[model samples]
Target: MSERTYHHGDLRRAVLTAALDVIRTDGPSALSLRDLARRAGVSHAAPAHHFKDRSGLLTAIATEGYDLLAATLADAPDLRERGVHYVRFAVGHPAHFQVMFQPDLYRPDDPELLAAKARATEELRAGVADRTPAEDAGLMGIAAWSIAHGFATLLLSHNLDRPVGDRDAEEVFRALTGVTFRTQPAGSRVGDDTMQE
Candidate 1:
């Protein structure tokens, strides 16, 4: 459809969807507003009216990602489940996840981006608040984020070893963090504090 035919916000959403598709297949460096406009069947100048520049477009993507992540985190029942949701969000939205973490790709100082980031951060920290001692909550939060983010990154990059096989990401994360470390290889044994009689 032509730019004028997009009705209010539809052009923006269409361009954003096109950008996501490009990032998914070719990475963010491949994004071109002109190409996005062409994909959306709009004027060459159409994307610019909404995003202004490449950085602005990326900022919009990151803002949407953080808002989505915050909502996903809010749905979890507890901190551990929140961690699962975080990994799920990252794996599910690899393009947005990549741009969200790489500040150089977007306008970090954008007000709307900052607000969306704050919401996601608040949801993440809220999960850690009552679960740990006040003195250690900060570290605990970082640790929890580290695990989820690291796992998601590895999984996305195909860096996770064969031992993990084709297991579901959420299940692997749960096994890695909970009382059992079932994600480990077959020969591995969980340490035993009560094995000896």
Candidate 2:
């Protein structure tokens, strides 16, 4: 094997990027810091500087994923749009999505991971700021998160085999949301804006 060298000043970022690439193509089971170092053209021990071990590296990936998801969700116009954005991000960044939510595999409490997760949560909250009341914000957040997360998980697992047409998954998601929430318009008199409330 050719020994490639990464002279890039940002070794940590390089290692993380390489790790993400591996996760994308091979799934989380195949990830390793040594392997990432190799892919990044750095010495086997180089990754250790940034990520003390495999778990650390995975945590970094999860943290980055949260940040990315937060950015995507923040751009949506409303809560429903945020849900669509959530699904899109999950589908587009399967590797990151896989690592982000698997608390068993990564250290969710890591400072970076926690911060990123908080940012994403805040973004989701912002999306529903106008429509959902302060008292119902938490419930609204959970409901929206559940819908988007459930749908994305289903799609990722191939549980939903419906052949979506030329329309993007976001379009299909909106349609699904419409069908699911048709009765409740933006100003509907709902109980705490929650399904169980």
Candidate 3:
């Protein structure tokens, strides 16, 4: 293979992007730094320079996942929306979601990962704070997370009974939560913003 070079910090981003694509297509177990370098068109040693080993690469992915999740949740207007956003994030970033939860795959004790996880946890907890007492917020947050996470996992694995392409995830989530969707005009579709409950 022809050797390639990256300018400045582009190498790290390229490797991470390639890693995500590999993980998304074949799961994290399929990830190889050498293969990642080839996918990124970089020197064989390039990925190792940014991520020392497999675990280090996984740790970086997990850290990035938590931070993204936190930001996604923070953008929502309320707990319900946050829960919906969580599922959306999981589905959209399946590789990240898969890696973030499987603690054995990465160095969970890494400080940056810990901090990012804390931020995500805080965002989740904050979503439930207004609805529950301080002592119960944690439990409620977990409940909300469980619902969203389970739904996303089932959806991702094609375990859900419905036709995924025909339905809006947000609509299904709202229906599961006992909230009915408001009617839309003729020719309206699942994701046209009119399907929101």
Model 2 lDDT tens row, 1-197? 22344455788989888877888788888988878877887888888877898898898889889999998987898878999999999999888998888898888778888999999989988976789888998888788889999989888876665555355778878988887787876775633432231
**Cα lDDT of all candidates, in order?**
0.87, 0.83, 0.85
The prediction achieving the highest TM-score against the true structure is: 1
Superposed by TM-score, candidate 1 places the C-alpha of residue 49 at a distance from the truth, in angstroms, of: 0.3
Candidate 3 residues 1-115, lDDT tens each?
Answer: 2345655358888989999999999999999999998888777888888899999999999999999999999998888888889988998899999999999999989999999
The deviation in Å at residue 150 for candidate 2 is 1.1
TM-score of each: 0.87, 0.83, 0.85
RMSD of 1: 5.9
Q: Which ranges of candidate 2 are over 4 A from the true structure?
A: 1-6, 163-166, 184-197
- Candidate 3 TM-score to native: 0.85
